[model samples]
Target: MPSADCDTDHRFVKSKVRLSVKVAPKKRGSCTRKLQVDKLHELSEEFRRELEVRLDNNEIPDQDEDPENEWQHLKTILQETTGEVNGFSSRKNKDWFDENDAEVEDLLKTKRSCHAKLLTYPNVQAAKAAYRTACSTLQHKLREIKNNWWLALAERIQSYADMGNTRAFYEALQSVYGPVNQVQAPLRSSDGSGLLTDKYSTPFWVAGLSTMGTFLVTIGTYKSPPSKTYPNRK
Candidate 1:
């Protein structure tokens, strides 16, 4: 019995004897592992909540708050908190992003249909084509968030011809043409030619300078011949 007790003590001493070892962590590997673990933990609670909701909705304890909405609210709070702590709340960057977003939205809202009224003029087709090209380019730029489009459009429309291509042309023309033709026919014609009533003046100018020139030629030919001769005498 004494030999058996000694053997038992020897076995206990052998089992209880511990080795003291100090293993240094590999700095890069340990950092990567810790980061991965932290990211997993960061998202794990939300994932767990979602899983619980999906697996057993009735089992989840509710505190008078909708779970999905609450989760979204939590996510927003987390983002705001992270942004603050990480110094992501840069005022200049935030303002720039907001301005860019608003500019893109404004460009998106500028539809081609808004130009329909301006399309009624004779010279507008080419201008409208150019405008359509510009608008298409602008839309593409907006979607990609390229910032130079405002400058590009300024250069495109700087031409006087382009100005005439816009609704401003109609407005300027309308001011000259409207009162003259919109009224009931006046008792006397301005030139006393009787060739043009005020009603005809509207059509002449609205059809542009070519139509007005044609009207002048017709009226002049009816009145008198031009006092000029050709060199060939044909």
Candidate 2:
């Protein structure tokens, strides 16, 4: 960065970031199932009989075997029984997915191949050109597919409302706004050895950057590196 000569005394604002991610421990014998809520009441008796028959056929776990493995085997039996008894709902696939799927997939595959080739041959002009071309083609295809999906969703919502399925209509409408995807990462010190939970964190951040003589401009709440301007003759 010191060797980057841009004809200016203002330096670049370089930041060192370290991410400390906490991975949750996986439950060995956990599983989830989806079934038609309305049909559960009518099929309660049938489900009980099927589950009893299956449990009778399955052998008891040996005392010498690992408990985790035995528990996992029991979970598998429950999952299989539920699927056999309740079965899957016949849901319709969105129409937009069927449109240009092969062409879109081929474009994506080409883009990935071009990216690998570019990485392998960094100085090759032909590889870089092919990568750029592949990116543009894939972007165009993805954009087309997105627009078609939105149009199809609108049509489906209208049909639900016309059929007087008030519950489904509202649900479909809510989906347009999309689900919340906000994740707040924990703030850490520059050294990455300690958490920034006190007032000293702000001062430390400012003092560290100040020592570097970095060019920083603060306009109200916005902070950015210095912007370059030029005199235009038109």
Best-performing candidate as measured by TM-score = 2
lDDT of each: 0.50, 0.73
Clashing residue pairs found in predicted model 1? none
lDDT of 2: 0.73
Please give, for residues 1-234, the per-residue lDDT of candidate 1 as tens digits: 112221122322224657998998877653211122324456666655554554453333466578787677666554543443333322211222365777666654553332432344426676567556657766677656544544443455455346567764444444334434356654433455442466876654565667778999898889566799768865
Residue 86 of model 2: what lDDT?
Answer: 77
Question: How does candidate 1 fare on TM-score?
Answer: 0.18
Best by lDDT: 2
Q: Write the per-residue lDDT of candidate 2 for residues 114-216, one digit (tens) a residue.
A: 8777767879999989988988887787888889788888999999989999998987876666545799876665777554566767777777788555544
What is the Cα-based TM-score of model 2?
0.41
